[model samples]
Target: MPEKKLNQKRKEFNKEKMVGIWSLVSLEVTDENGQKTYPMGEDATGFIMYHPEGYMSAQIMQSGRPQYASGEVLCGTQEEMAAASNGYLAYAGPYQVDEINKMVTHHMAVSLYPNWLGDTQPRYLDIKGDTLEITSQPVFFNGKEHNTKLIWKRVS
Candidate 1:
């Protein structure tokens, strides 16, 4: 192929690269004291997807969540429901990509945590072939402030 054609092809390829389903590899939280922790446990799991229509969805959960004794979806006691919610994180909304800056902003239209609704968060991104890493600004979680770094591998 001609040099110009090759360059154009590469650009197109890059644009489509971010649109796919990705599996979580790891999630790390760093505190002000430089201590690192995994809020979802060492074996946490999740998936994040970017659709062609400018929408995205992400879900993360701690491994081995407990089942409520009631067995019914809506019959869980307050404690059971709290445990389930505390172990999971999920949100979906339209997203904007700034490829030149290696950043993406997620506009949260729906979220498992009510406080996150209508929030727009910008995340720095580093994408290499099938792997993607995203880092966020400091966020207050369960009281203390921390920053998050998440690594994901393309699954589709």
Candidate 2:
């Protein structure tokens, strides 16, 4: 077998492994001091979808968020919006999977957090059966560096 053919095969295999809807199982952030926290509360609900065509989107939100009094996006008070935004994280864009490196880089085209827009976030991946665990590289969150681990289970 040729080396190029082998690499192509590997890439195809990696893409296949990621093409599916995955439900968030758990999300944990470990800070430099080794303290673990769930920024999205104990019960976070989210879904991440990977398309064979190399696009992806993700949305995660902490459970039990308070409802807006006006029930309108524009009518939300400053504190309401801030609370909502703090409890939710969403982004979508094209993605690339490096099979050899076992990493997935998301080219964020849009994100709820403005700072993340246009950023390329790379996550180390470990796929096992129905479970996919992605670990973000050390990221500064709340003035401290933390590594976030998101566990997902294949939904379809």
Candidate 3:
């Protein structure tokens, strides 16, 4: 977090380690008092992929989302569509890794949430064996600041 540390080049950390598809394990949000909660339920499912071409994509959602009564993809009414969006998140864009900081920055060129479009977010990355842990910077939402930690496992 220091200024000098940010300028140092990474020695052993390689950006290549991040290139792979990962299955979501868990996403935990912790508040200031250390109380943790799951934003998409405890058994949420999703995938995050880091492409070799310096790009990344992540899609996450609560499992067992209600299906529209029409059984059609595009026929969902406003209420149905809003419910779907409320339970899902997705984004993709070129990414950059700052190995010194053990961080990866997701430049949101596109996202399901409009506010995230063109937003750049830095996530701390810790990869061990086949597991990758990405911790977000403190985020203020839902009336409180929280830290989110997402765990993932390599699938390919």
Candidate 4:
């Protein structure tokens, strides 16, 4: 085989290797302090559905009871939290995967962060059998870049 052909085949193989729905059967996210890690409870499960349509669905379980935010913003302000508690249980979205870079970029979200409507976030993922290691180098939250790491195990 020609050198160019061989390279192309390698690229194709890498792309095909990462195509699938990786469920978050289990998860552990480290806090900003980095001194401790938080593990999701048994009820804390989610899924990331990757589609050939250049999109994906990423959803995570809500914590505790519902907490609805006051005003138009889905996220309740400190004041709003005191008024009512109506949040969410689970949310999903569309996404695209760049196999070459091992990065999965989300196109649109259907839950969780509504402000991320059309925003795109690229997540670096390392998959080992049913286990997945997700590292978010600098995710902007509340106008601050947060270093986050997440590990998930496939239950289904």
Candidate 5:
């Protein structure tokens, strides 16, 4: 019944709850004026995976993206590249969960957006049933501060 042993046990239990593949249900953002918007369209599809070894990756893309005319990754026109980049997001890196604080920080080693690379993004976590809701700290998007809420359902 030692305190250190109890704390370690709790950490293990919490870590176990976080390891799995989660499918994106919704990604919503509420601006400073309290208007909600779906930045990735209403039917965006994505998945986030958490590994027991403390790594995670997330990729979310807006649905119905048009195919490139050239069908080549580097041959897309400027307009096509812009449209594709604007509607897609991907990042991967090591992640750490603070069970006591109810937060998870994703140490971004790489990201689609250059500014996000090498950033430690912390998200408040709230897990309910099969859903995991992660709320980001107020972030500036399109010139306004917004808090993004990503709801994920356990897939594995």
Candidate 6:
């Protein structure tokens, strides 16, 4: 192999090593419809840490009032945010990193969400430095679609 090619491969390998444990510090979500937008503040925040043991876990809190499957938007209530995120805490199972595709896939989600209560496909992963931003895109539940984002910071 050429020296340049070997160096490139080494760099790619190094980036994967950076995918270790991380903690959640803060997060913000924006719901946009063309020109109108809303910021779901700090309620949707938590820590997510990945282990070399082939598993990762996350806990997220809904910060602002966002619509739930029950056809209700919390709208400026912490209790509502907490209730909305009841199943979002302590989700774990296994994960895989795809460097060439710039993707990370999570499987077997032991989460509170009924839709993800069992094995699942890769939902989201965009890692850079000490931050790993993962999202579960809009999914249709009860004939409605909702988009969400979860952010975490490296602690270990």
Q: In model 5, which residue pairs have backbone atoms overlapping below 3 Å?
A: none
C-alpha TM-score for every candidate: 0.87, 0.88, 0.91, 0.59, 0.88, 0.60
Q: Residue-wise lDDT of candidate 1 within 1-156, one digit each (tens)?
A: 798877775574454678999999999999888889999998999999999889999999999999999999899999999999999999999998876566889999999999999999999888888998999978887778999999999999
| Candidate 6 segments whose C-alpha is farther than 4 A from its true place | 1-15, 26-41, 62-88, 136-147
Give each model's whole-structure lDDT: 0.91, 0.93, 0.92, 0.58, 0.91, 0.60
| Per-residue C-alpha lDDT of model 2 across residues 1-156, encoded as one tens digit per residue | 799987885864487898999999999999999999998977999999999999999999999999999988688899999999999999999999988778999999999999989999999998888999999999896899999999999999
Off by over 4 Å in 2: 1-13, 140-144
In angstroms, give how far residue 72 of model 3 lies from its true place: 0.9
Q: How accurate is candidate 2 locally (lDDT)?
A: 0.93
Q: How well does candidate 6 score on lDDT at residue 1?
A: 77
Report the error of model 3 at residue 113, Å.
Answer: 0.5
What residue runs in model 1 are displaced by over 4 Å at the alpha carbon?
Answer: 1-15, 140-145
User: Residue by residue across 16-108, what tens digits does model 4's lDDT show?
Assistant: 444457666445454455533344444565666556666666666534634554445567776566433232223456666665567777666
Which has the higher lDDT value, candidate number 2 or candidate number 6? 2
Candidates 3 and 6 compared by TM-score, better number: 3
- Greater lDDT among 4 and 6 belongs to 6
lDDT of 5 at 125: 85
Summarize candidate 3's per-residue lDDT along 15-57 as a digit string, tens digits: 8888999999999999988899998989999999999999999
> Backbone clashes per model, in order?
0, 0, 0, 9, 0, 7
lDDT value for model 6: 0.60
Ranking by lDDT: 2, 3, 5, 1, 6, 4
Tell me, by TM-score, which candidate is best: 3
